[model samples]
Target: MVKRALISVSDKTGIVDFAKELQGMGVEIISTGGTYKTLNDAGIKVINISDITGFPECLDGRVKTLHPKVHGGLLAMRSNPDHMKQIAELGIEPIDMVIINLYPFKQTILKENVELHDAIENIDIGGPTMLRAAAKNYQDVSVIVDPSDYIKVIEELKSSKDVSLKTKFKLAYKVFEHTCHYDTLIAKYLREKIGEDNFPETMTLTFEKVQDMRYGENPHQKAVFYKEVGANKGCITSAKQLHGKELSYNNINDANGALELLKEFSEPTVVAVKHANPCGVASSDDIYDAYVKAYEADPVSIFGGIIAANREIDIKTAEEINKIFVEIIIAPSFTDEAMAVLSKKKNIRIMQLENIGAPVPEGSYDMKKVAGGLLVQNVNRECVNKEEIKFVTEKRPDEKQIEELLFAMKVVKHTKSNGIVVAKGKQTLGVGPGQTNRIMAAKIAIEYGGERTKGAVLASDAFFPFPDCVEAAAAAGIKAIIQPGGSMNDQASIDECNKHGIAMIFTGMRHFKH
Candidate 1:
């Protein structure tokens, strides 16, 4: 018996050539709508789905592939005697292969001024149904969901007369993944339209496998990268590694964190990230000065950390970067001469993430994973101004201290929970992040700052729960403090600062980074 293959696609690229290859292998080609037209126009033997079902597409083409004949051919198990008998009795031909691609719902909605009706219309129903049915019978039928798989399928057919079971299983998995992602995009859009935060009780997330790393964070664990389904503008995952070694799990994590921190600054900036925390960061008139000040902020921690710059890397900056044993370097662009110099370090992963500084849309949520659940909250993108700050102390912070306070606030916004940043002038003197208590974070910052903490201003991402943090800051010779004054013990903290003769200001905005 001749094997039957079904081909239904919205994207018709290389469809004719693929169908011809299947025809040469004695496989009957069945297609619908534009696929059938394209195959026939190319002088390839094709059987339209309407001819097999004896029914023209109805309901404005939405009811085309919902017929039993198409589904039965796709879902039947060839090894089951009862199924084979039923197929024969019902005149249902076995579909040996299924090639399908869904409509571009994401692209449709991405267009400027797109209407809701057009977006809803682009949501594919029959395509996913066909793919799922075909995938479910992977043991008997081969499923191809991507156009890139066509050539491989043709090659396998020409060589062995049939695709392998492993290849079929992989393709089946891909089909399910593709359909799941398509449905997710549609569902997310619909949910957003209705203004509902509660999603379906059963949640499904789909991400495409981007790469398989050599190992995970350590040598023992295994890991791979999966890009979330959508157009990710300015995402580190979408960046191109122009040169250097393959990125490790830690490298990608640090690089992503560095990029996120750098994205907040419009000016030329450099951020040094270590263990997913910003060890040092500075914005300067030039990229070289930015790198110099950022590196000088904490030379010890900057030794093996990731460095991200918003400006193009030049020879002067590259020379300064080469002095350290940096793990990863990311920038918008790099001069050819700079690349040549940096290439000497084979272990350094260099990435060119052009336009990575694009402003992100407001009201985005940040997610963190715990043992059994996740915590989600809105991102801290609030703008701060000096006039909005309330100086609650007699000794108010000077103008220079206000500038440092704002800069420290920006740095603290990117740190983990219980973050405290101390800065004097425009340089980050010390950063104590990811502590269990604010006082402990303050102590760490003071210890790290050493002599530099004498005249520096402290910026707390959140409000002080008690006056203990303020006492710690005063003991470290900190002259001023900036925080979101919302604590019930705010008066106690204010009294402690007044007794210590330290200046304190409230910005009325919290900057929790965790």
Candidate 2:
């Protein structure tokens, strides 16, 4: 029997009708501040918090619900004789139902140019306290934090004359989850404002679920997509799906790889990714040419892969893309004519990201989950420092070869460890990723490049331990090589490059993406 109900909410959706229903059931309503005014204006019988607390709402209405009467009514166990006697002696009525939602701290902080004081003021203290109190005694109390539960509670009350104990327990669990999410947002915002960058001893991250996928990377595994807190403008998570079926787990994973590699270039570029590794990449004067070059880079491997472009996709690009089978195409924008042509495929996912080239925000962390733990590090934002590059070979690379080497380096940086990228004319001819040995990776890339390996450049994510990789590149007629160059036997690889008259540059930085 919910005789006394407390209703205080920052979101007033469906509150009037809900309070009216409670009033009709002879349940007294206790509210405070804006909620009280809204209910009173609507002509619903309501008692202000001060009326029940016997204390005026001092400290700008902050002290209204902090009184003993409000909590004692909510926390007292009705079935306990001692609890009943204590509340009876103190003249505190048991509050059987509590409906509350916290202040809009997230919305307030999201406002442009919001001040520290404004965000701090929006944090609700009394609301969480009352919710937790009511939820703790859920066996004797029915608490509702979400307005969507109002109709269900009303339906139950109408039939069974009370909220079921199972429903009350679920609602109690929701209160703790809601409060934890709220507090995490506040903590993250404050930490950013105060310039705290170091990882905390204990970290609590909150993400909103975007969708539940039919399955994960494999059909047997369950999976879901979650969006990080705050605005993410350029990433695949922020992209608007324009056509095709819901994104599968594999589609999202491969598309994210293409997007990350695509952002490395400011020029019109197209990146084709398969299984979270770039299969082909190219940059040209226009999107159409970029797509053609990227397709030609590896026509066989790019079939049913993800294509990501930095510029708006035009009709010319779309028509060429439609000739092949691709799982996804994501770009800054797409022309109406291009969309019409792409939509003919029916199943290819088309995504539009207006800010597709936005840089990764500072202090962003890249996290990977492992068994029983998580690996956290800063995002790999650097490809190379051009001025710091060391020409280790006697034959320095020409300006054209230098550009090609740098281009390949950027692609290799995003590839898995023991990775090798072979390129020519700002396009990747072949990529060998996730190999156990450097020599094997070089051989694989060279074999894939085939006839194109002549005059092409090679980029390794890390230094070669021996001269075997350089020897293999020389045999394939590779003109230049770029690597981090921190190996103990670096001289052997440099000597091999010198012997073959191949130009080699040491970037002094390793990018091992395991």
Candidate 3:
């Protein structure tokens, strides 16, 4: 039976009614500070913490419940005679139940320009200590940290006059999980403020559950979505879904790829991604023209793909989008007429991200999970520095072709390796991604581009290993080429480019997306 219950909470959502129910069952309530006043004002009989501990809540209410009387009562085991005898000799009654929630450290830190002292002040010391003690002796004590679990405890107590061991064990598990997440948040915040090393010896990351998906990448796998602790405004997790049933794993993956590529341009741009690879990309003076150019880039491959736009989507863009079966449409904003047209397709996912133009925050990590280890590196922020680009060929590219080459480099930067992109007029005509070899990738892009390859420029994510890629591009009548030029066989490819009068620039940087 729950004879004596201690209640100290930062979140008092249903504490009043819960305390009243416990009091009606003849269970004495012990509270401190605000919780004590809240219960006492509600006309429920309650004992103050100072009365039970014989010590005032000193140190600005920090030393309220960090006493032997509180922890001893909670930790004492009823089944052990020595434990009962020791507590009895000290005149400490057993605490059968504990209700607590920690201070809002996350919310406090999330505030705009919050000070370190204010954030440190909001960290709860006694709350986690009390929760751990009660949870350790869960066989004899019921610990409730979440308000949502109040009805479960109430229902169990009303029927059997006690919380079941199974429920107690589950609640104890939750306490450990909650405390772990809380400690991680505090540690991460302090580490950022203190300017500690980015990658420590022992790294710990915490994320909050967003939702449980129906399946993972495939139907047979189970999966769930979790958002990072402080996800940036530019991230896909920050997008607000206005229409559609729910986002699947593949949908999120492909949409994120499109968004990352779309952030590369400041002008009105549209990016199409299929299976986590860019199928088409384009930039224009207006969003409608960008969408049209992007769609026309690869009309066949873009079917059912994800489209991301940097500007507001209007009715004309929505009408053109409605002509095809698109998996998702993500933009900064959607006009009312655009939404009305897009909403007609009930299966299309519409995501509106307000800060879609924000670049990736500095010092963010790009991580990949491998079989027995993890790979972590800084995110790829730059495609290439314009001043660092070298005109390596005998024939130099014109100013317009240089701009077009830069635009193609941006598209190829996000493509999966081995990657090659054929582009003209600031639009990708063909993108060959994830091929086995460089020449194969080049051949694929040339074949897909066909007649368009006659005057278009080509961009490679990495250096060419041989003259085969240049020979293929020359045969396809490629006007110019851009790639990183660190290969041991770089002279061979450069000689071939010069032999064919094809202008080639060495960016001195490789964007290899494996």
Candidate 4:
């Protein structure tokens, strides 16, 4: 039976009624500061914690409920004869229940211009201490941290005059989980304030499961999607699915790839991804024109793929996209007519990413799981402009060729390793990703591009090992090329470009998406 309960909560919702129910059952209530006032105003009999401790609340209300009287009451195990004797000699009354919620540390710090001292002051001390003590001695004491659990707890107590040990254990575990998550957020916030923003020695991450996927990449594997805790702003993970069926594992993966590549461009752009690889990408003044160019890049590879556009979707773009058997389409917005037309296809998933135009915030990390461990690194968001490029060939590329060359490089960075991209003007002619050899990448891109390869600019994620890629580009009528200059045979590749009279530029930054 819960004879005495302690209530000190920052969130006062439903506390008065809960205390009334406890008082009706002949349970004594001891509260602190705001909680006491709220309960007293509601005409509920609540003993002030300071009155019970026989000491006044000091230190701007920070040191309340830390007295020996309170802790001794919560920690004295009733089952142990010696423990009961010690508590009786010490004049400590056993506290059977603890009701508390920590101070609003997250809320206070999240406000604009919140000072460090203010955030520090908001971190509850006595609350967590009392909670931990009560949870540890749950065999004798019942702990309540969440107000939502009040109704069920009250019903259980009314039904049996005591809660079962199973229920007590579950509530005890909840306190540890709650405190662990609270401490992690506080640690992460303080670490960012200092200079240890990158990675901490004892780092903590939190995630909330979004949904269970139909399966993994294959039919036999199980899969679930988890969204980063408090992640509600950018990226596909935060996107709202506007229409269609539930997202499969492959669909979400490819959609994320398409969205990342789509963010690389500020202009009206469209990117088509297949098997987590970009098969088509293009940018233009008109979104419809961009979609047309991207789809034409590799029509065969784009079939049953994911399409992500940087700009709003119009009726024309939707009509053209509807011609293909695409699995997903994600963009900023869509016209009523476009949605009406596309809604006919029941299986095509459509997502609206509101922050598609906004840049990704700083301190974002890319992570992957490995055997018995995980790999974490900063996202590869750097892109070189015209000033960062070095003209490597004797024949320099013209301004138009330079513009197209940069566009191709943006698409290449999003592709898998050993990737090659051929682009003309603002449109991608062909994309070759995940090849065993660089030369094979070039040949695949050229073959897929067909006649469109003529007068197009080519971009490679990394430097060419030999002149074979250059030779293949020359045969395909690729007028200019852009690649990182890091290979020992870089001079050989440069010499090959000179021999073919092809213009080449080096970015120095290599984007290897393995």
Worst 10 residues of 1 by lDDT: 358-367
RMSD of 2: 1.1
> Which scores higher on TM-score, 1 or 2?
2
- CA lDDT for candidate 2: 0.93
* Predicted structure 1, TM vs. truth: 0.88
Pairs in steric clash, model 1: none
| lDDT of all predictions | 0.86, 0.93, 0.93, 0.89
Q: Is candidate 1 or candidate 4 better by lDDT?
A: 4
Model 2 stretches astray by more than 4 angstroms: none
Stretches of model 1 off by over 4 angstroms after superposition:
11-18, 58-60, 75-92, 107-118, 137-140, 147-171, 192-202, 383-388
Estimate the lDDT of model 1. 0.86
Residue ranges of candidate 3 with Cα displaced over 4 Å: 195-197
Best-first order by lDDT: 3, 2, 4, 1
Per-candidate TM-score against the hidden true structure: 0.88, 0.98, 0.98, 0.92
Runs in model 4 lying further than 4 Å from the true structure: 12-17, 195-197, 212-214, 229-232
- Candidate 2, residue 361: the lDDT equals 68
Relative to the true structure, candidate 2 reaches a TM of 0.98
Cα lDDT tens digits, model 1, 1-514, are: 2289989888888877888888887888999888888888899899989988889998888988888889989888888999989988998888889888988898897787889999988988898998999899998899888889998888888788888888999999888778778888787677657764444566555567889999998999999987765546677877899878888888888888898888878888899999999999888899999999999889999999999999999999999999999999999899999999898998888898887786544434466779988766555556466567898887888888787788888888888979999887577889999999998898888888898889888989899999999898988899889998989889999999999999999988877666
The backbone clash count of each candidate, in order, is 0, 0, 0, 0
Model 3 scores worst on lDDT over the 10 consecutive residues at: 194-203
